[model samples]
Target: MSEHDKPGRIAPYPRPAGGWDAIKFSAASLRQEKVVLGNLKAFLKQNQPHGFDCPGCAWPERRHTNRLEFCENGVKAVAAEITSKLVTANFFARHTVTELMRQSDLELEQHGRLAVPLRYDPTSDTYRPIEWDQAFALIAEQLHALDSPNQASFYASGRTSNEAAYLFQLFARLYGTNNFPDCSNMCHEATSRGLPGTVGIGKGTVTLEDFELADAILIFGQNPGTNHPRMLGELRDAARRGATIVSINPLRERGLERFSSPQHAAEVLAGGSTELCSLFIRPSLGGDFALIKAMAKRVVELDDAACATGGERVLDVAFIETHTVGIDEFLADLRQESWSLLIEESGVPREEIERLTQLFVRARSVIATWGMGITQHRRSVPTIQLLSNLMMLRGQIGRPGAGLCPVRGHSNVQGNRTVGIEERPTAAFLDRLAAVYGFEPPREHGLDVVATIQAMLAGSVKVFFGLGGNFVMAAPDTPRTFEAMRRCALTVQVATKLNRSHLVHGQQALLLPTLGRSEIDLQEGIEQSVTVEDSMSMVHLSRGFKPPASDQLLSEVAIIARLAEAVVGNRLVDWRALATDNSLIRNHIAQVFEAFTDYNRRVAAPGGFHLGVASRDRVWKTASGKAQFVVHPLDLDTPIHRARRQYGDQAMVLMTTRSHDQYNTTIYALDDRYRGVYGQRDVVFANRRDIDRLGCRPGDRVDLSTIWDDGIERRLNGLLLVEYDIPLGCLAAYFPEANPLVPLDSVGDESNTPTAKSIPVRMLPHLD
Candidate 1:
């Protein structure tokens, strides 16, 4: 097929109110198919109970209040799970791995859930059914055959429960390697690494209840409306209460602009979308660091003004003096930063910056929330630290209405990290783990996702095992990631459905089908419930209601247990017992980590419990027992220039994003309703002048190539252009499809998060 003929290659943006149309469009799509309302009804009721949490977003539930707790995307998530489609051995027999690879990610997922354990036979290029025991034995043999434990890398998805993740990490460590690379490396590694230096903990310090009391909410780099629909209700409620909600993002996201909560009966019937952001500040792509630094400078200025007037110190003098260090140095660095640099870098006018600063100064309490946008940049870690520093200056931490909120993507992503899923495990944590498990844990830091892929390409890594994730597609530089997976001696995936990662077959691969969170988990003739931690540090239990789609499907814990037994035969830990009883798993966790003391008992309560954020009590965990301010000398090596260069004409920096109808890599439909895009996912939204400058018209074919070190290139033959209210020198496109263009080597300086938000790309006429 020609490039132009491909779906998503060339399509026009839909008219405004496309979201309203999408509600109809999706309904039509569902009407044509058999609806499984029974499954959905039962599944939603089991949410936030003694079961596994929803694998979609990290938005907290409202204390299990209503019968209908599912959001719009949550509906899509559960519908995708309860999908009538199935990919059995027969389906695999019909299509070769190569043939499946040619299909789109949507088409791959549409093939449906894997009904049984399947092993890839390279000779036939098809996956064949394999017994669970045989699958475990094969994986054990391949891992054991590796020259060293470092040659094996363990990848995890955010979907895995805390118990399952704990066991997976324990098993990997017991096998003698810290090569644990996870999804966090690709998304929020900056927050995970940077927040600890600013606050006492790596996770968010606020609870869901804090939103109700917050006087001001500053949302940075997050589009909660689509990515996290449930958050809209909270934001809407906060807005209704007259709290100032400021949105800081490069794009004017509809979610941040306005949201009509489907849950709100009055608004839903009246067709009214509540106004969300009181002030929407659009910063340039990769300009978050500069903008935050400017905000901190403003705070310093405000502090000086208040001191000169003999008024109350606006800089939280008490908090800083007691719990922080290096403020003087940070102030010096802020004063030295030129206004011209801040204006040029942030893409926001000086007047607008002053206006935002004034609002911050006026607010008595503030809550700062951020997402991947801030984390996927060159100075991601420092940017996060700066935000934390700003919050500290305002005395935001430890209060009911003020704190730091890092909007985590997955339901259990935070939980996984909380329970021994770190690439760099501290000596203290390892010692505790050793004391609990009765074995010396490896002291070496493990490889992250990017490092693991690089090691695999370098042939230093051999076996690859994913607890739950589409690592090949989710990772940056798809071609390289896929090649690395194929080069592995053995690949094992524990998943619920068929995805692009499954098609990227290894020399020998095994697909261990696992039960989804919505499905019932029966073990040893008893029902089981899994636990997950939210982004706000609230731990809750999740109980499944609907029966398992496949009788052969096993819970994640069961799969891990079987693998551990096969690999570590007669090991110190009782893997089988832990799998059969999650309480025992919690007991082991409590023994290892102090934070999880009385884990089993505490989790049995209604909403579980709070993990306790030490920073909330004004405790700083830095070297001097106080929050230390670190200064970064700005690198002027690569300045933003619009002139034609060796790479290409100085085009806009394109930040790939997910459409309203999509989540992460999952494409439910080909429509970004909020952006007025419909029946297509390949169209690029750009300012009208950009198209004219390139001598291209709407629906013109174009190729986008990144000028990054890792030779990764992506071209979309024809994309329908749309004139939008976007800032100059900026472009927006859909993700996962555009993920291939983001090079593996182009990562944040300190956090190593793939720079998915800031890629310098050039646009050109499509070659016939």
Candidate 2:
């Protein structure tokens, strides 16, 4: 049975983050995964020079100065990837598809690594072993049978290597389709879409070194303790160095409040913790847009006051005049904005907004960082641009210690985009691809994640191919997404282990087992190393020393190359050569993308090379040749706000969160140590006043029914309520479990990212 059906404990955690508990839990994870201590040699190499990058968060690596370069969650990801257990054909034979569906996500992953290729057998509701060549042939047949290339939707996960992602995109385009719906579409698409027009770069401009030199760090809607544990060290050092750290999130994250490094024996032994955040601001869910506007308003107000008093100018007038455009229109909107409406919309007191603004003003240099919380909202794009406006007012960009940083979830998610795994490819990028290779790439844009699902429901998208990731669990509206997947004529998943997406198959499905990130990738009697780009746009080599989980497993590059060969054939480019030597693929990448010039030799350097961002050099790529301060009208018509308008006091905004034990869709354990939830994944966090006002009690089990105009009755049942530190009228729940509450149509404007962070929900009495 699923763990969601089980009872769990909720208690207050007495200690700060990353103490003895972190070490214990990490060790427990390694033991649970059956990774012996002797095998830990590979773990030590994580994030080190000439070593593989951690397959967890996209946090950049600093110069190797310590023995242990991995974090607690990094160890969990490493343990899960290099586990000794195997899911052989016998394991599948023992459990039918219907039976396996009853198992929880954690149980499915814990069954271990997939050892061979499997093809779905509808007659027995089981998967049978299939030869690699035969599997490729089946895929090619399905593609050929498709009415049009657009009928096939190619999806990629962030876990894919640069070489593999490049090959995957190349294959899809060569086959004549731009339907690449990637994981970035769900998470950082807001940053990708928003930042380009404003700052001329979609990715973050800050480097790890910038964090060290920053005078103040403003963290927005991100919890570093769980999502990016390694970042805690940086935050800790920043705090110790007297840098002002401001945490602007709904819940008071333990990671942001205080962090005790597990690696530091002195701190752990002393049972003391370093306070991370100087100020903590809790805004309502989806309130960042208004909160940021309020801060910007305060900045302009302070500047006007300072000018009137003949004091030092608060606004960098000279810098603004030189480096920015649209300031007059932006300032006009800010000046006209009502403080009462801003306070009501943000649910933040005017004093807190002023305090945050003062911190931004006092700091000589600042770094603004955010995560999915800032991206998964209706006004996410404008909110980010507003943040840019705040930074530009102080001349923060193009400086050593001040820039924008979006903390990406997956290890290579940013890299995946860098290597052409995008649905809407730029004409210049397509032109470069056509010039480098001997083919005319597709010029028309293609379907993203949400569009792909809509197409599948309409029976237009027939084939679904996934490079990696559990698409069923990752996408919003879990049941509807599953149904959409089931409607596909053929589905193909290239993965390392079993997931819900594998069982919820199409009319015909193929499961191609691939090597994990920790496995040795050998091609043509030589070991091959893959490259990945960290969150900071640093492209580095990732080489694994361990043997493959099974001999049947192939590297992701090999799988894509062989599949491409089977379908497209060796007409334009030699797929076989590209698969054997990743360097050749790197050469192709360099030719296609100018940033990767001399990719092979440059990546071989110590700590790898940074693919430079133009925004850092103040070279804005916008039409006006200056940073654009685009303005957005105050949007109270967002899903949550609309629901409030319709439902009165019953409406509450909900956000999906990741547990400490899990990364993305992969669950390692049930315990959320930081939140003091033991053995549970089905709990909702709410403010005590909301619980009381709503006629609900702590520990009450309830069902969350999403409020959408589409009339689809989407609900997740039997969630235990826990009164906690959060803003009024807002609730928090674990992702994938709470993913059901998010309507597929409810997405960020312009970005098209599912509004997982701001779902309008109504609590109902638990049924069944």
Candidate 3:
């Protein structure tokens, strides 16, 4: 029996990625879904040309995908979505909203896909079934009642299709509000903000095929085991082909350690796996800036040595002088960043830094990728700029097998941003959009995720409209966010399943049920296929095969189009026509976004077409008309220093993490299989030394309090401590649950992204 079967014992999980355990888990999920042989066939079609896309992650599919084109997590996500479960209005009538809110987030969503539109009646304390027309009318009434257009905030989730996102943004702009707060604002806003200054584009320059040619790949702050299991196959293949894979993270991840591919029969039969990750470096939380700077320093010094002693220099001086600017100023900044300070902050030895530099120097081509771990910090923008500077020195931006790759977490997140889900839209983009749609788009910038919460708290925002997400649970300062949301006059969620966001409602709230990715979407008389972009900017068509769960369910496109029609009907464009046909929306998208030219014609291709990023061809769209060597100063007050000065000597930097069985705020199970955590979510992972120093034992319950000058006490209670491999002066807990401890004011510099991974906190004995 698993540790979940027991009450208190926290089991320690061993073994690497894709073992027999993965197979068993996949089988268990299928069994739970009550899948048949036909369902198995449908599962195999995922990520293919004719089938639906995997709703789990944004990892790019191969040009020619495999027959079994999904990972274990992909299977779990599909199974979860296409489950044979029902949570009818009668069920809600039996259980009050107050009583439902008391259940876990997992339990709330596990109530299953909503079959019809619902309206929360506070007097009854339960959701009542409502007509779609009535729901739209109610929303339109509330929206028009708002004093100003700016009083409303529109949110878009990453799961939204490109067509739906385009129409949704168009509708919002036509309705007169640029207050577009999206999922990207919370996670990768730093990458979307920082990289454009140097690379001319916010997206990654490398393609999926580039991984095959990479001599050395540097992965920073991402774990592929639980978060992105599909990436493990690529890493495993790279390792088998003798490529060097380097990992820099706080914890030792099993995905980078070894992987047993379920595809390989020999490996499965022999119980063997391929070893990945040539080098693993553990840096202190928020220490990536110093660590990367030290590596850059070593590279510059080595180049000087080679030039002075008569040898080929490490840096591509041609590329630097011709393709880049401010190299001299950048080197000056590196020289001032002392090795002693770097070693002290980075917690990486001088020898390791030198070794990392040597690997860079020897590599013919390199690809440096990062995830939320590097982005969810106070200095995230500067840190990413430093990474860009490192890439510039080696001439990696425009070369084959070399460039920066900011791996997107959600299915169509990058696509949504591409199709105009940005708060800060360029004048050129707006001008083109206006030319196509004949409406003056909002010139004023809009509120992001954090700013939206602040607006709601100040009572400046009256309406909260979400396309698909649990904003209250996914955001920082959960208690504050929950209260802020309650201040809204109206809250609307266009979702497929029930979640905590539905419970933390405004005075009036509506739940608009939509079709899932696994279900068929029939707009008029014809079935429609949606397009989504992957991490590498590859857009492909996804057509669902399964029947709709309920006849009352509508597609996201239909809902957005209907909402637009009800609010602002056909003034700018024919909203009713766009609802019936998604191709028209795609044409509108093509006219607005330049890269998506020939949208309808090209998207019909076998693997779909690349947006063809100009940065990939050595084109730098910066103000200087070339790639830039942006300088980032190393000396600053990190989170740890601020915590010590404000809270006490015992304050530690806390990081919000996700469980193995979770996707964003949606919890699939209460257990985190890889971490050996089971049947519980109220647990914190800490170093054994830190636990002892805190006068706490393994499994000892504790309370966490945040350290900040917000003049408010942010605390989380009833957390059990678990000893694990991590840096000292750091604590790890799952997000949404731990979001309460992160202050709303604690945001990344210039990026405005929440510093969820680097909040300072102190652990106290649980009195309860």
Q: Which ten residues in a row have the lowest lDDT in candidate 2?
A: 1-10
Give the clash total for candidate 1. 6
Candidate 1 lDDT, tens digit per residue, 705-728? 666544445555555566666677
Q: 1 or 3, which is superior by lDDT? A: 3
Model 1 TM-score (2 dp): 0.95
Estimate the lDDT of model 2. 0.91
- Which candidate number has the best lDDT? 2
Query: Residue 208 of model 1: what lDDT?
Result: 88
| True lDDT of residue 746, candidate 1 | 80
Which tens-of-lDDT digit does each residue in 1-768 have in candidate 3? 644545455787677678787887888778766665676776777889878998889998887876577888888888877876767788889999899989988788677778889999989999999999999999999999988899999999999999999998888988888899999999999999999888788989999889999999999999888877888888888888888999998887767888898877688779899989989888888889989999899889988889999999888899999898899999888877788999987878899888888998799989999999999998899889889889888888888899999998989999999999988988998899889878899999999999999999999999999999889999999989999999999999988888889889899999888988888887667878899998888999988888888899999999999999999888778988988998888888888777888899999987798998878898889999888888887755766687777766588888999988788888877778678788888999999998898788998999999888768999988899999889988889998899998889899988899999888899888996
Poorly placed runs, candidate 3 (over 4 Å): 1-7, 646-649
lDDT of 2 by residue, 405-470 (tens): 999999999999999999999999999988888899998899999999999999999999999999
Ranking by lDDT: 2, 3, 1
Candidate 1's C-alpha runs over 4 A off are 1-33, 43-52, 638-649, 709-716
Candidate 2 similarity to native, TM-score: 0.98
Quick one: RMSD of model 1?
A: 3.1
